[model samples]
Target chain A: MTRITSMKPVGERAIRIGFEERISEETNRYIAALCKAIEEQVHPAVTEWVPAYASLTVYYKPETSGFDEMKSFLESCVKDVHDLEGEGGRVIGIPVLYGGEGGPDLSELASHHGMDEEEVIRLHSEGDYLVYMLGFNPGFPYLGGLSDKLHTPRRDNPRQNVPAGSVGIAGEQTGIYPLASPGGWQLIGRTPARLFDPEQPDAFLLRAGDRLRFRPVDEKEYDDLCSRVENGEQIVEVEEGEHAH
Target chain B: MSFTVEKPGLLTTVQDRGRQGYQQFGLSPAGAMDEYALQMANVLVGNERNEAVLEVTMMGPVLKAEKDMVIAFAGGNLQPAIDDEEVATWKSYHVRGGSKISFGRPVNGARLYLSVRGGIEIPEVMGSRSTYLKAGLGGFEGRELRKGDRIEVGEGAGSSEVHAGRRVASEHIPSYEKEITVRAVPGPQEDYFEKEALEQFFSEVFEVSHQSDRMGYRLQGEEPLKHKNGADILSDATAFGSVQVPGDGQPIILMADRQTTGGYTKIATVIGVDLWKVAQLPPGGKIRFKKTDVHEAQRLWQEQEDILVQVASYGRS
Candidate 1:
């Protein structure tokens, strides 16, 4: 049985439901199942639900439901969430142009790992990464699968401006910069995929429970895909994957 | 039904209640920092609570009304005036076409709201008029109001009644102060910190850092709260009022424009009712925290909402 350690109030209108201290697939699936049940049951006052590595934070409208009422409602809802089998997140492929302008730190990262840049790209592209959460910045995915050999510390002095679509690695995790902003990640490559677009029916390219893989592309191919994405073309491919838990 | 910006203020932007149902997509609910003030200003001028209004920060914009409009100012006092004639805040005013409205330096608080009846007629993006400055997504052209910008007002936004002389009851208004006691509910991660750090957090008086903005209020105070397992936590979903303490140990109260999730441990979350109070606090203002449970926090919020409802009812009368 998946254990839910506690359900505490984040404030007046938001509730944080905790599972355990560490990040694991079981916790992620439990959160997903819980989120599924809540959405199915539909708490009228709940305005938003955020699923993360270990917990799900629910934001609600105070005027519609007070803390006591909501606490009980969530307690009841959790009791009915019996199925531990979490839904399989869709697998999406992100095409990247590795090395050179798009990947300024690729050589540095490869040298640090005592491997060639091509080998580094091969390791990164072959792994199946899980989308633990979307955070830090809009549409930024916190992915969970990184080859230990390619582990690199973040830049001591963060970049004033990291270009949008740049793929970077920090510690054991890898992610893509959804927007051009200040960051400390070690840039390895760039993805032409539009991670965030308000105009799309689905504003964000990725969600909390999704599987992603990187496919290496040449600079010419990157330019072609970039134009296609900019022109509102869905160039990336998404397919079904195995259930999380 | 329209106005022209003669002089754009430091950070004037259109805001409303906020954009809902989008936080899951890594979008923050960017809206009026001081919802209480925005709501009151909207109600006084016969506009809906969600109607878009101008949020003025520190300095205020110089606007020239192109048509007769019923408007109200709320929140921090920027010493608003029409053609050099002072106009009292918290009350609706009937201004004639060609009236020039300007504001002096802030007399109190950090943010002020200017609402015209019928609301700012800006197209909604993701179901909100509030500006998400980081994404450049919504509000007046996805950014702050600039000089020479023309803002259109919604037709029939104003009620026939002038609403002049109408003011929120004195007790209903929140007086901006340099020192404030903000109530908070202990954390989603309160246990992550050491017992000594928790004591230090509750006992210390922290001053808002100079870098504090709509995104979050960074605090500068005593030794940063030390976590038993270091400050690093699995990046988790953060609420609007989340008081995230980073590696530096400074506390940052995530606000309307905060990120959807954070990696730091949140020691506490300011109650929703008190968020507006924190919003009004200027950078360098002092804040002390008092622990309260969720039940008490909700009761206080409901009480405040009831008062606002009673005040809004006065507009109808």
Candidate 2:
């Protein structure tokens, strides 16, 4: 059973339950599982549940449930949740165009790591990143399992606008920019796939607990994929992963 | 049943209580910043409390009523006038077809809520009409009110007799003050900050910085509060009214359009009942935090809910 280190009121309407202070796939899985269990055990007062790296915040209607009532409900629910298993989600394949104007910091990142640009691309594409959570921006996934060799700190001066689909790394984590926003990550490549689209039937291109793999594509392929996306085509491939944990 | 936007003001959008049940997927619950006022405005117009209303920020929009309608203005005194004739706020007004309703200088507060007899008839996205500007979803075309944008209203009772001259009591309506005191409960991460910093945070009067927006209010004043260890904390879910202190030590109070999660340490969370006070504070407004326990916060919320429930009885008897 996962030990819940603390449970406290975050404002009058919400209660934050912290499982651990550290971030790990196991702890994140527990967070996700606990989130699932809480949703399954629906309390009318609980309006929303937001799961993060190692904690889950439960937003409730204060008029319906007070702080103590919600806290007790969460405590009992957490006690019932035992497994840290994550239900294996879809594995999404992302096609990337690496080392060009799309990836402004690629050459700098390669040299900083004492590796060539090609090696950087190869290592980055091979690593299977697990989507821990989606936050920061709409549909922006916080992925784990980046190769430690490629770990680079965020830029001192963040770029004013990193284009959407710009794959970047910050500290030990890697993610893609879903929208054109100011960011401090070191850009390494650009993906042709649209990660966030309100117009799409599914809306968001990714979900938490999904596995993501990057495959390198040339300039022509990138343009073709972009056009396909604009034409409202689902070019990105999704396959079944191994099994639910 | 409809109105044409003659001149869209600073930032006007449709909002209800909020977008709920989708925060887990990283969706911020974009809604009316001053929900109490939104509810009161709806109550005055005989619409549901969660009905979508026009949320005017900073400035006011110039709209031409396409049809005779009963509308109520609440929250923020924008000095609303019809055809240049001044109209008192917190009361229902009847506007004839082709009559122009314009808001002059903002005499008080930062946001104004306008509710017609019926709610704004916009397509609901994810169970809400509230606009989340960052994602371009919900509200009218998922954006702010602009010139020539025509909005349709629902069939609100279809009564020819307008409930004009109906007003909420002066005590019921919150007066927007240049200086406000917001009550807060110690946060889930209150232990993350040093004791001295916590004392300094409560004692100091903070000014709302110009950088403040719907997302958050960045306060500026006093020395930056120091964390017990460092500012960096494990990324966690954030709530509206969460007061997060970043590396610079300034507290940023998260609001209706805040991101789902953040990594900064949140020392405290403003109570939900008092968030309207925070929402109405214009830029350069002064604020001081008074620490309160969760029970007291819950009591305040219950009290507000009771008053709203009582207001729902208007026009019924």
Scored by TM-score, the top model is 1
Clashes in each model (backbone N, CA, C under 3 Å)? 1, 0
| Model 1 misplacement above 4 A | A84-86, A241-245, B158-161
Candidate 1, position B232, lDDT = 83
Q: What's the TM-score of every candidate structure?
A: 0.97, 0.96
Query: Which pairs, if any, clash in model 1?
Result: B118-B157
Off by over 4 Å in 2: A83-86, A241-245, B157-159, B315-317
* Number of the top-ranking candidate, with DockQ as the measure: 1
Looking at model 2 chain B, which ten-residue stretch has the lowest summed lDDT?
B156-165
Write the residue-wise lDDT of candidate 2 on B175-283 in tens digits: 8998999988988888988899999888899999999988999999779999878999878889889999998999999999999989999999999889999999999
Model 2, range A19-58, lDDT digits (tens) per residue? 7677677877677667777878989898888788788889
Docking class of 2: medium
By summed lDDT, the worst window of 10 consecutive residues in model 1 chain A runs over A236-245
